[model samples]
Target chain A: MDFATLLQILDSALRLATPLLLACLAGLFSERAGIFDIGLEGKMLAAAFFSAAYAYITGSVWLGLAAGCIASMVLAGIHGLASITFRGNQLISGVAINFLAAGLTVLIAQNWFEQGGRTPALEGAARFQNITLPFSETLAPVPVIGPIYSQVISGHSALVYIALLAVPATWYILFRTRFGLRLRAVGENPAAVDTSGVSVTGLRFAAVLICGFLCGLAGAYLATGLSANFVKDMSAGRGFIALAALIFAKWRPWHALGACFLFGLLEAFGNRFQNLSVLGVDVPVQLMQALPYVLTVVILAGFVGKAIPPRAGGAPYVKER
Target chain B: MPKWVDVALIPLINLALALAVSMLVILWIGESPFEALAIMVKGAVGSAYGWGYTLYYTTNFIFTGLAVAVAFHARLFNIGGEGQAALGGLGVALVCLAVPWPHWTLALPAAIVGGALFGAAWAAIPAWLQARRGSHIVITTIMFNFIAQALLVYLLVGPLKASGMSPETAPFPDGAALPTAHDIAPWLGFRPSAPLNISFLLALVACAGVWLLIWRTRLGYEIRAFGHSEPAAVYAGIHPTWIIMATMLISGALAGCMAINSVMGEAERLVINSVQGAGFVGIAVALMGRSHPVGVLLAALLFGMLYQGGAELEFEMPAISREMIIVIQALVILFTGALDNMVRMPIEKFYDARRLARQRNGRGTGVAAE
Candidate 1:
């Protein structure tokens, strides 16, 4: 492939990676707090629909983002009420929430728009436009660094930059803050945290709510930023892919960005070359699409490196006293 | 306080709550919920035609629900039912297409064996991973689901595709066709086109078999023992790996058997997306049924009605789409499975107070409540 083609692929990869990166960070927080949320996909889907719908109605992207975030947070709150307060099985609650979001989005969309569960395409102010950074015109003359900086890095929606920025912010919050220490302690040993007079429930809820907010940003990016409107099931298993990326990252903030970008690059290539072959043998498009899942399974099976989860992950806490 | 309350009354109340939510949703969409209900009941069970479709759908749910319940008994969440069912469908297609037998009686047995084996094999890797490698079965099984989807697509459009451009195989051999409800009992005056088949009977037999295995056998005891407490079970000389592997195999086999209803009985061919979302619906059924075979049967029937009725509901009222069924199913799962204690707590408090009052009045403990 030519350098231009490679740069173009990287640009799309950056765009695609934005949503996955945000969603991965979302899972990182929730899972780090011992709240294993399989509802990430559902929240993203619901948020995508609401964001697009509100953006179309008000012709304001900011309002759409707000609506999307609220929708996701509401789902997360329901999850907390079930898994945290009621002490129900976390997996079952996650499954229920996913179905709720999946069904509600399509049902409401069909009822409101009659457009087969899709919002009308956003125009002008309802959509996020790509921003080209300064000195791109002058930077074009420079060799390798110019195109990589200007073309590949500069031209993306604001959400892309935000997602990239969130990685470092996530690192700082999780590893360098007192709240982060308490959050990790809760996930690892809630009974210990409880004995210390820290509210385990409170910390977990904070983590889950933050998860919702990040997922909301991911969904909003999917609908208005990456594309102009919401399509039914447009998240398209990205939430699960993000979850897989979380596992691949060993639940670390910085590692999550690398994992998501790798998956995104694979996706970009799969999109670009359906029939391209390096060897004499034919490669099917489906195999390319299935690679991430297969790779994750291998990783999970411990053939590569160990990817252990939090000590108390997927368990509902009960007071020892 | 009573076993009967847990088995019957609690689920019934939860179901009521779910239906109530559905009603509100219908109202929100500017449709009359009562009229919609009437239409759904009529469309799902008022006629033999509707019953046929409902029972047909019920058969599939029974297999999938039992599949989930079996794994759940061993404390394993087999969320990969959708993928397992697809692979089972692949097995059915292979067996049915392999030979031109003169009778379905012969074909059915071969298909069952093939389907079960394929389903079990598909689950084996994930189970082994959880058993020996300490990998999370939940994540691996889910990944296997995506892989299964891709594999099915690859097989269909490549080696398995028929003469047409469509990504499905040609019909199974004529002899492999199972008898429909109308064929079995023409005196009932059912339409020949009704999809209900002998697979419904097979589903009941499987349910009975599962009930026997779970409650009447030693392996069942071990599974229950492991689920209740792994450390205790391990101390009792039961191997955790053995229980996990055996339970998952049975679960996958049952899930795979669902293809017999949709593929061999009705479609008579291997098709893309044939399982649709029936596999996921099994989770709701298993949860609502409390993972008991009898409960699974009842829950599967209710869902079947929802499936058939929701189709009719959409036909009668465009305002309420078919996706409305999923919403109702979700509510049912949420109330019955996740927020079960929400209702359980208040009921427990009320029952406890009444019991204490009765005891204080010198009524014996075993007396039935008036």
Candidate 2:
């Protein structure tokens, strides 16, 4: 590929990776706190619908973002009540929330808008605009790195920068902070954390709510920033793809960025080259699309390296007499 | 404390709560809950035509629900019913299309084996991974669902697309067609186009077979033993690997049999999205039914009614879309599965309070009798 083409693909890659990165970090927080969330998809979908719905209604992107986060947090709260408060099966609760989001989004969309479960497309300030870095124009006349900076790094929605910035933020919070240490301890062994005079339930719910907040950003980026309107099931399988990326990255923040970016690059290539071939043999695009899932399955099966989840994950905590 | 209360009363209360919440949602949508409920009831059971569609959907759920229930008996969760049923559709297509049959009687047996084997094969990989490598089946199964969809879409749009226009296979020959409701119960004057077919009887047989296998056989005893306590089952000479694989196979096969109803029986062609959300519905059914075959049957019928009635509601009241059924289904799962603890604890506390009051009244002899 030419450098220009590669840069274009990279630009799209960055755009695509933003949502995955945010959702992956969201999963990282929840699963690190011993909460297995298969409902990430549903949560993102709810946020997507609400963000678009609100953005279209109020014509203020900030309100839409706030509404998105609150909507996602509500579902996160439901997950907390079911799994933590009631001590029910975490996986079952996640599954129910997913269905809840999936059904409620389309139902509410159809009720409010008569256009078949879709909000009217947003234009102008109701949607996120691409942000060009300050030096983008000045560096345009330089060498290869100039155009790369201008095209790939400079021009992206603000959410993309936020997603990129979150990698470091997550690392700092998860490894360098007292709360992060407690959160990790709660996931690995809640009883130990409880014995240390920390409330295990409080830390876990905090992690879950933070997860909701990040997912809110991701979903809003999709509807209002990426595509301009909410489409039915618009989150698609990206949440699962994010989960797969989280597992592939072994639950590390920086590694999550790499994994999501790589998956995004694959999608970019698939979209760019519809009739891709390798060594005189045709390669189906579906294979590329399915790679994240296939890779996660392979990793989980221990065919490559082991990817163990949080030690206390998927189990509700109970105090023994 | 009582068997009937645990089995019947708690589920009733949970269902009532789910319906109440659903009604509230209807009211929020600016519709009359009572009117919607009346329309749904009248549409689902008021006529032979409604019964036909309800039973058709009931048959689909029966196959998938039993699949989940048998696996639940072994303490295994098989959520790949969607993928398995998709493969089952491929199997049915091959059986009914690849070879010529003089009549559906001959084709039915062959299609059943084809569907069961394909579904079982798709499930075997995840089962083996879970049993041998200690990989979680939940992760593997959900991933396999995405892979299955990708694979089927590739095939349907490429090699399997016989019509060259749509992403579907050519219709099977007339001889391969299953007998519809009108063929058997013409006296009732059901709609000729209704999809209630001979596969409904097959679904009934599957329920009976699953019941016998779970409660009446040695393997069933082993399965229940394993589910109750792994260490004890192992001590009793039960092979965990065998139980896991065998239960999953049975589960996948049952999920596959659903193709007999939806794919070959209804569509008469292999199409993308043939499984729809029936596989996930099976999870809700199995949970609501308490993993019992009889319970699965009842839950399946309830869902079938919702599905048929939801369609009617969508037609009669365009404002209330068909997705309302999905919202109701989600509520049922939320109430009956994840939040059941919320429902059960209150009832348990009530029973405990009553028992305590009885003991305080100098009727403590009743406790010993219990």
- Scored by lDDT, the top model is 1
> Candidate 1 on B123-234: residue-level lDDT in tens?
9899999999998888888888889999999999999999998999989999999999999987875789999999999999999999998889999999999999999999
TM-score of chain A of each: 0.98, 0.99
Off by over 4 Å in 1: B353-370
Error of 2 at A74 (Å): 0.5
Docking class of 2: high
Q: Which stretches of candidate 2 lie over 4 Å from their true place?
A: B357-362, B365-370
TM-scores, all candidates, are 0.98, 0.98
lDDT of 2 by residue, A239-280 (tens): 999988999999999999999999899889988998789999
**In candidate 2, what are the lDDT values of residues B1-370, reduced to their tens digit?**
6789889988888899889999999999999999999899889988999999999999999999999899888888888999999988999998999886789999999999989998998899999999999888988888988999998988898888996788999899888999999999988878899999999999999999999999999999999999999999999999999999999999999999999999889999999999999999999899889999899999999999999999999998888988899888988888888888897888888878888888888978568356
- For candidate 1, the lDDT comes to 0.92
Q: Where is model 2 chain A poorest over a 10-residue stretch in terms of lDDT? A: A88-97
Clashing residue pairs found in predicted model 2: none
Worst 10 residues of 2 chain B by lDDT: B361-370
